[model samples]
Target: MLHCPRTVARTIVYSGIFLATGVSTVLAADPTGDWKVADGVANIRVAQCSGNMWGVVAWEKTPGGKDKNNPDTAKQSRPTLGMPILIDMKKKPGVDAWEGEVYNAKDGQLYSSTIKPVGADQLEIQGCVLGFLCGGETWTRVGPPIPSSPSNSMAKGAPKAAPGAPPKTAAPAAPPKTTGAVNPAPAPKAAPGQKQAAGQPADIGDICLLPDIARFAH
Candidate 1:
């Protein structure tokens, strides 16, 4: 092959551009780590799973939390610690954004969600039940990552589910008993499918701050 000077120079320029683009893409779109949410009241571990990403609750401020608000009657028995909050996130090509579903423990609803990094250290996680009625929280990358909290063992072993198995939905807690210690944040009266504000709870302020309530109010 006859190497022309002009052709060689053009090839070098193109190769440099391609390398730079690849490097930037690699650096920009990874969200693998422990993320502090709810004003550091809760933390989740995000990791790659089945060609996507999932986040599970590693810790909560409130001890031995339960998902008292879940809609699934059967799931109310599970503890809130190992519940999957951020589900099946797929990265948007050429951007620092991911699309996923966010499970809100407050109302037991899963909203369409997106996670976008505002800078190197912070991520903006927004979820929307409807376009106008949406809210988000800022998550800070806490550290490289810690071992899955002892409480989160249910979701720690496998990154992805088995083939043909149903996807793992958010774990729910058992139905509340008439113990009088039912400390769930009250969901305000709304029409069907109308969700409460991202962080604000309903009218129940009498209860103490349990893990359930601490992460609800914005």
Candidate 2:
């Protein structure tokens, strides 16, 4: 997610300290939300999917950008939107930070990375090449933190239709059996800013259900 070159030797000193101090924070800090990158070139939407943290490109300052620099020839023409930048980050035991690999689309390389929340509004990202040559930047929160989705909810709730295919219609359900007791009415939709009840699926358009993330969610 960081566009800065990893060859900068000066960043190692500060980044080393940053990574070290990040471990002191208490656990249970949530990082799910939209974040504005340091350079303001793009915003990433982070969410919990299949019990791990993943971030995808949600918005770009300049539209219609392609992943031209990607190493995979077949994917070079693909649009950058919705691409996963944070690759399956898992929470570090007893710490608030996540450890994973970050895909640097600018250079078509993946680096070992860690993301840590700095207070409630800032996210610190650091990446290292060969376990050194570290560099990072802080991303500011763009919206309120999202409540963590139930584990694997995104995958389970993901639409079954293939991309560009027409959606399938479900058959109508049979009439309920006649009984003295009446069936309870369905639960009301969760109001905005309210936490969803446990086991409830996320919205169909949730970023965690995107193909790039959904395929790896399980």
Candidate 3:
């Protein structure tokens, strides 16, 4: 059946956000755990690889461990079930979540995935490739492990402020002194040939500079 485009778009956007930011107890360092595939067709071993990366060792198993999807009975030459299928990166820090692409060997289709830690011993995995084709599963921790360091880019420890305390303040400066004496300069008097007492003599280039202002104008 067809679905509304807006609803599908919104679902993908929200799903991406959740996948990108969800929390997990397991470090990106390793995936050493009992990962039950979301489709119930596989069981995976998760563990750490070099440099904080994750590795997934998968095995073919039906949802009920039946012969379905089993390479052994299916006469498949290779058991994709025991192969490492997921690569988790640790190159940059600040990644609070884990995401990857899900490859279906049967159809060669890749789906987007998100993993979150539900507890110290288990994780929640979600995978979705299309609008209505999403699935989820739970994984449990297993075996001895090499502790993975938090991503180098992950945010550091708490800030250094005490609770309920007013912030520190600096001393205020003193105001400047206002007392001062005032003095005024004397004004100038008009030059010769000037009609107004406030007016000065014209420069050599001006008609006003002529001895007879009326002759110059005529």
Candidate 4:
């Protein structure tokens, strides 16, 4: 959650628009990536894990912040970085938006929320308190667009190859025998300046891999 007074004020000011626009154009929407919040206070990394969309605090302009306002005393001392804000959101049918609960660390409350990608570079986040005090801001995309995660598809009942299954291609001819035991070939490494592939591990890696998001992965 964006724990800033300015952001909270904007939410109140734009509540009307948030309520009026129930859905936006569903243009090949894929919101999995790092996004800079409207206030530039933090970067939220969103990813599809276990068939659901989740986001977390990836970076903060002023680092080392704590969840002081969290109602649970046990979590008050926890760091805000990597905290789960966008809970288990499910894709809405025929729409390019996801609906779920958002955790507002500012007040330690959960609000009904929806996230919609506006174009390719902006993400609109709107939330309402008791379906009245609605407001949201657009987040700028800071990372490349990501595709559907394999784990997400698998969770959605997509078929997966069984473990230890043989390759689909025809078997290759046997190699000549060697005197000494042959060590397995080392894994390939990324080029010095190669960009990380979308949906693959990179800085902040997969948000779903985080402990907080994993709890709601199913």
Top candidate by TM-score = 2
| 10 residues in a row with least lDDT, candidate 3 | 177-186
lDDT of 2 at 45: 73
| CA RMSD of each candidate after superposition | 15.8, 17.9, 40.7, 17.7
Per-residue CA lDDT of candidate 4, range 1-218, in tens?
A: 66798888889879857664433333237787778898887778777776668888876666567999988899999988888989888999988899998888889999999999888789999999999999988999876555553433334344546999886774497533221111222222445875434342224555665667655563
Q: How well does each candidate superpose onto the true structure, as a TM-score?
A: 0.55, 0.65, 0.38, 0.64
Residue pairs that clash (backbone atoms under 3 angstroms), model 2: none
Candidate 1 wrongly placed segments (more than 4 Å): 1-25, 145-218
- Per residue, candidate 3 scores C-alpha lDDT tens digits across 1-218 of 35688889999999988775553333443344445555545545443332333433333332112223423454334434343344442333464456765445554455677666654566666678774589866766543233333222222352434888787674497423111101111222224653332222111111111222212211
Candidate 4, run of 10 with poorest lDDT: 178-187
Candidate 3 global CA lDDT score: 0.42
- lDDT tens digits, residue span 1-218, model 1: 56698899999999999999886665444575666785766666565443455676655655467788989987787777657787777888977788988999889999999988664567789999877589999898764422222222223244545789996675597532211122333232445765444443222211112233223311
For candidate 2, what is the TM-score?
0.65
**What ranges in model 3 sit over 4 Å off?**
1-31, 36-42, 58-76, 89-95, 105-107, 130-132, 148-218
Model 3 superposed RMSD (Cα): 40.7
Report the lDDT of model 3 for residue 27. 45
Candidate 2 structure quality by residue, lDDT tens digits, 1-218 = 35455545558877888876774343226677777899988777777777778887766656567899998999899887778899889999988899999999899889999999988788999999999999999999875565553434544556565879985574597533211111222333445765544533222236665778767774
Ranked by TM-score from best down, the candidates are 2, 4, 1, 3
lDDT of each: 0.61, 0.72, 0.42, 0.71
